[model samples]
Structures are given as C-alpha cells and as structure tokens.
Target: MNREKLPVLLDNEIIEIRPDQSLLTERYTDFGINFINNLEKDQPFFFYLAHSMPHVPIFASENFKGKSKANVYGDVIEEIDFNVGRLVKTLKEKGVFNNTLIIYTSDNGPWLNFGSHAGSSGELRGGKFDVFEGGYRVPCVILGLM
Candidate 1:
C-alpha cells in the first residue's frame, strides 16, 4: 500500500515539509491551550481543535505509542484523550471551565478495510463509504455552558 503524504499548514501556508505526524495531537492541543492562556479573562474567544489521527496511516507519539493493548489504533486514541485532558486542564486553570462549551464528535465512521488499524463501529453494519448506519452514525458529546 502507498503511504499518504500529509503536510502541516498554518494560515493556508505550508510551514513544515516533514513534521512528525505523531506529535500532531499534542501540537494541536498546545495551540488551543496557549490561545486560551493568552486571552483576557473577560474576553470571549472561540477555539477550534481538529485532530488528524485515528485516520488512515495512524500514528501516536512516543509517550502513547505501544502503551495500549489495542495496538496502534488504541495508542492513537489514547494520545488524543491525553491531549484533550490537557486542554480541559488549561481551561479550568483559566477559570473558564464552567462557562466554556465543549463539543466533541467524529466526522465519520472508521474505515473497516484497514483491519485493526481502523476503529470499530461496534455492531453497526458497514462503515465509512458504505450507506449503512455505521457509515453515518457517530458519537457526540456536549459539555459546559450550562
């Protein structure tokens, strides 16, 4: 199989030619954390963090790689979870945790063709390109802003 080449872009410009994809989750989280940290306490801001992992050619940082029993796929998810925790901690430290609104969801189901490298849609039939419920069904979580 041919490995996909992914590039890192900033402001619609390529910033790095060969960024370590494994650290992308942490990097995205850090960007969000820093943005929040530098904001005025009373100022309203919006931060959007979109991760690229858990997709084809998945990867996990050294801290998370090989740390899960569910193989590389699990490692990638664990890394995402870790970064999300860090983001939440930063929000709480900034005293905006209670007022912040967090919405988390996947764009689509996993690619079942990748075998263990892809996520499971549980008992849902089909995935990704298929027209079954598994292809469109996804988990969504909304928190805070109460």
Candidate 2:
C-alpha cells in the first residue's frame, strides 16, 4: 500500500488514510468505536458519529442477515441501528450517558438509480440531487441532549 496515493489537503495540512479500510460503507461506526474507546474520562467530550448505512452496497451485516422484512437495504439499516445502540450502551456503561449529547441524521436523501437499491426520502420529492423537497428534506433524530 502506497501512502502517497491516499493524500489529501485538509486545512493546509496533508492528510492520509490507508485504503484497506477506505470503503465509504466501511467508515463511520467502524472508526467511531475506536475514537470513543480512547476518550479521556477526566474531561467532558463531544462525539459526533455519522453512519454510511442503508447506503450503497445494501449489504446486510452478519447479525442482521435474514432478519429484515424490507430486504437487503432494511437489514443494513438495522445494522446501523444496532451499532448506534452499542455506542449508547457503552456510554451508559461508562457512567457518561446522561452527560452525553447524541444527534442522529443522514447527510442527504436516499440515492436513486444507483442499481436497484434505492431508498425513499419519506414523502419527499426527487432523489439525492434536485432542488425538490426530497433533496433538501431528510430525517433527523436528536437524542441524549439539550
């Protein structure tokens, strides 16, 4: 693996990440766990986790396999949900649950026409692009905070 191949400029700094774990589908929760586990307990902290779930590949994780009634996509969502639940549980276990702030959401509406694994924007118009309601409209869930 060549380190130079994965370089990017961020805030005037060159940043690099190994490609073996570069799947957009493989980020978020997978890396988030590491971040949370290494947190220092003496100071209050903020952790924002965004999942790339129910997104592309529509792959069902092992625990969620054959369980979702909505097919492959649904299973992926359940996996996302499960991982999030795990994070919450971990916080509670650490006695920081009440002091934590958790906000859950998607970056955009469901993608369309990228193979057969399209997602609905829940009564919105159009897909990920377009200025329609769907493009700018998506679900947002707030949890564990003010």
Candidate 3:
C-alpha cells in the first residue's frame, strides 16, 4: 500500500458533528464565516461545502423536526436545504453571491434497507458497494456558474 502521503489523523481535535444534529450547522456556520473572512477579496473564492445528511440515523434539526413533505428522509433533506439556502443567503448578503459557484453532490447510492432514511442512490444494483448503477451512479447540479 502507498502510505507515503497518508494523512495525519487529527483524532484529538476532530469532534463528531452529526448532520441530523443542530451542532452540524453551528460547526458549519462558524467555519463558513471564517472561510469568507479568509478570502483575499480581490480573487474569486471557490467554495465547496459538502455535509452528510438524509443519510442514516435520520436526525432532523430542532426547527425542522416535524416539518417536511417526506418522512425522516424528507425532514433531513429539508434540513440540508436550509443549510444550502443559508450558504447562498450569506453570499447574497455579502454581495458576492453572483461571483460564487455552488454545487452539491453525493458520493454513492443509498442503503435501500435503510428504509426511508436512505436517499435515492439512482437505479443501479447492489448498493454502497457494487459495480452497478446503484453503486456508482450519481448526478451533480451546477449553479451561479457555467
């Protein structure tokens, strides 16, 4: 195995921020502020904020606990939607919303067995681990940029 560039795990400072938990957004919002502040202002800032949600252990934020068209998955999705909206809202409020490029994506398929907690992993076979559409099939959405 190629271990020369193996990452130095920072288990000490890395705290578990569950997506379904409110702490996740708090953690993200804190870093989001820092991220914007760190931008040089003259150069364009490219940001990619990918957070796990509507996945497993489906836990919705306090505000969206019981609000949604879907079930737990829907509630979780709405929570994710809130975060995405917040990012855009921040950008717009800062007047840089036009120059920013935002995109959201998922890595793999959902665990069908996860029942409603799982997301639409696309129509493939197997799941999480398999050489089927259900495994590697995924899509991306691009906005604010070509």
Candidate 4:
C-alpha cells in the first residue's frame, strides 16, 4: 500500500496491516522474482511492479537506512536500485534476460514541495502538481528490445 499505516490487499483480501514499511521494496522485488522462477521456459508472462517508495512518509530497510548521502529519500532510492538489480539477476538466472522487455519509468515528477524529502526536477520548471514541464515530464528506460 502507498501508506505503510494502511493494510495491504491482495485479490481483495487483506494480506498485511501495518507491515514494516522499510521492507516494502524488498517484498515487491521478491514477488517479481518468485513469479519469474515459477514460469515455464516458453510461457509468455507480464509482471507489473509498482513500488511505493521515495514518496511521502519515506522509509528504508535497516540494511539501507542511513546508507545514502541524500538522506532518507536517497536511502529509499538506493533500496529501489538494489531491488531492481535483484530482479535483473533473477531474470538472468531464469534464462529470460535477453527475451524479456523491461520498462522503467516514474508516474510523475517529484513532490518538490516536500523540500529535502522530494526529488529534483533538474532544470525543469514546476513539480508534481504543477502545469509546467517538470510536472508532466518523467524519465523512461527500456531494455531487451532490439
């Protein structure tokens, strides 16, 4: 869930309440890895991983907390980076690395109003809720496509 204080639902069922927010990234990564491991070699599958991190009320697992120079926000981002690496490793181990298409991007710009807790839009104007470029522009990366 976006808010750690709320319950997490799976298929309309409550899976966890007040779960350790720090492990959110790890748990999501685990779910992706597990899905990949259970798939047949020729079976086509699509996995959508959405992470609720670096958002308001940020959190980082003990392994990554205070490990970044950019404070909690950076810690959360580092955790995400580490988890993405884990997923890539799993894909390679499952022999689907070259055939899989991976698309990574953000839904919107950072919440600049949050000050140090938010991300930088660089030279772009405005942020998350604004009508300027930073509000709508986001970064996208695609892999495994010729």
Candidate 5:
C-alpha cells in the first residue's frame, strides 16, 4: 500500500461570504470603478474584477431585486451587465477604453438542477460536477484590445 502523509490542516477562522447573500457584485463593481477612475494614463495598470453571481443562493441588490422578468438568476445577470456597462463607460471617460483589455468568462457549467437559480449550458450536456463538455465548455467574452 502506498501511504502518503497528509498535509497538516491549519486552524483558520473562515469567513463565509455567500454569493447569494452578500453584496458581492456591487462591491466588485465599486472596486473596478474606483480603480479605473484613479488610474493614471502615464502608467500601465492591470485591473481584474472577478464577480460571484448568478450562482446558487444568488442575491441581487435592492435596486435590482424584482427588476427582471426571469427571476433571481436573471436579476443577478442583469446586475452584472449593468456593472460591466458602467466599467466600460468609466474606461471610455478615462480615455483608456481603447487600451484596456476586458475578458469575461465563467469557471464551469451550471447546476441545471438549480432551476431558476442556475444558468443554462444550452445544448451542451453535463454540468457543474460532470466530466462532460458542458462542465468545462464555459463562455468567454473578450473586448477592448483587438
């Protein structure tokens, strides 16, 4: 039997920030907007905004709540879209829109069983934990730098 020593687990107080419970999207949007607004044209900067949304237990801010016809997932998506639009506007206002590179992508397939809370993988098969194409065949949208 091949016995491997397991790494010692550190005692850490993990703070749970539930994607659907906290203002995660709003906070990330603020961070990106602030960074873009304060960036200097004389120096190059790399801003990466990662948002956790449209996921399970998804929670949209009060402004976006019940604003969509789809449901929580749709509302969350709309919130993200609004934030992205704001980011683009900021970039354009800063005159760095043409130089910035924005890449939007997802980590994996959706949990179809999550119903309204889950995103669609379209015609792709398998999702989330499955080993199918849908599991890893996520969407990627690249803009700005051509």
Candidate 6:
C-alpha cells in the first residue's frame, strides 16, 4: 500500500505527529467547545467534529480509560459522548442550542481484526469488509434542531 504524504495543518501551520503517540478525541471536543464559546450569541456557526476513534488504533484519554465496562473501544465511545455533551452544554449556554444542529455519524463499519479493540455492528451480520448489514449499516445519531 502506497501511503500519500499528507500534511497536518492547525491554524494554517503544518505540524508533525509522532507515530507512537495516540490521537486523543478530547482535542476535537475542546476545539468544538472553543469554537462555540467564541461566537457571538446571535452569530451562526457550523462545527463539524469528525472523531478518528472507535475505529482502529482506538484510544481514550487518561480520564476515560478504565472507566468503561466494555473495553478501550467503549471508553473511546464514552469520551466522544462526553464531548458531545460538553458541546451541547456550550451551545445552550451560548443560546444557540435551539437553532443549532448536530449530526453524529461514521464513515464505515467497525474493523474487527483488532479483537477486543473493535466496535460492534450490533445485530448486523458481517463486519467492516463483508457486504452484509454490519459492513455498510453503521450507527448514526442526530441531535439538536431535528
């Protein structure tokens, strides 16, 4: 597999990521919260939080690890849930909750090769690779201004 050289940009600056280091989902949470907090009460904003976990090489921050009954995968999902709660709270406090819309989704089914680290397709047959429901019918939750 040929991997393309992609740049990681933050604030218009490219940065390096350590291969051994885990990417915490909390950063995405913080970014969304900060983005919402900085906006004016009447200002319209759009924040798209695409979490990279509950997938492969899954990770939960120190605070979330060992807090879930399922495993690391569950912990990552829990952390994501916590972040969503924080975003909702921020939106409500900023008086934009009623008008704001939040959509949570995944690009594909769970990767099962990692054993305990993989997520469940839940009642669906097959997994990330097969043509069954588990392969294509992943979970999606939509909240706010529905």
Model-by-model lDDT, in order?
A: 0.88, 0.66, 0.66, 0.89, 0.79, 0.76
When summed lDDT is taken over every stretch of 10 residues in candidate 4, the lowest stretch is 1-10
lDDT of 1 by residue, 1-146 (tens): 22344667789987876678888888988888989999996899888888988887788999997999888999999999889999999989999998889999998888999987899899999899988989989999999975
When 2 and 5 are scored with lDDT, the better candidate is: 5
Q: Give per-residue CA lDDT, model 3, range 1-146, as digits (tens).
A: 34343222223553432222544644565577667766666667666665546556567777777797767787777877777777777777777878877777778877778877776655457776667788777767778757
Evaluated at residue 34, the lDDT of candidate 1 is: 88
Each candidate: RMSD to true structure?
2.3, 4.7, 5.6, 1.8, 7.0, 2.6
TM-scores, each model vs. reference = 0.93, 0.72, 0.73, 0.93, 0.81, 0.85
Question: Which pairs clash in model 2?
Answer: 125-134
* Candidate 6 per-residue C-alpha lDDT over 55-93 given as tens digits, one digit per residue, 9 for 90 to 100: 676777888888899898888888888888888898888
Who is ahead in TM-score, 3 or 4? 4
- Candidate 1 local Cα displacement, residue 66, angstroms: 1.6
| Model 2: how far residue 28 lies from native, Å | 5.1
The C-alpha stretches of model 4 lying farther than 4 A from their native spots are 1-5
Q: After superposition, how far is residue 122 of candidate 5 from its true place, in Å?
A: 1.6
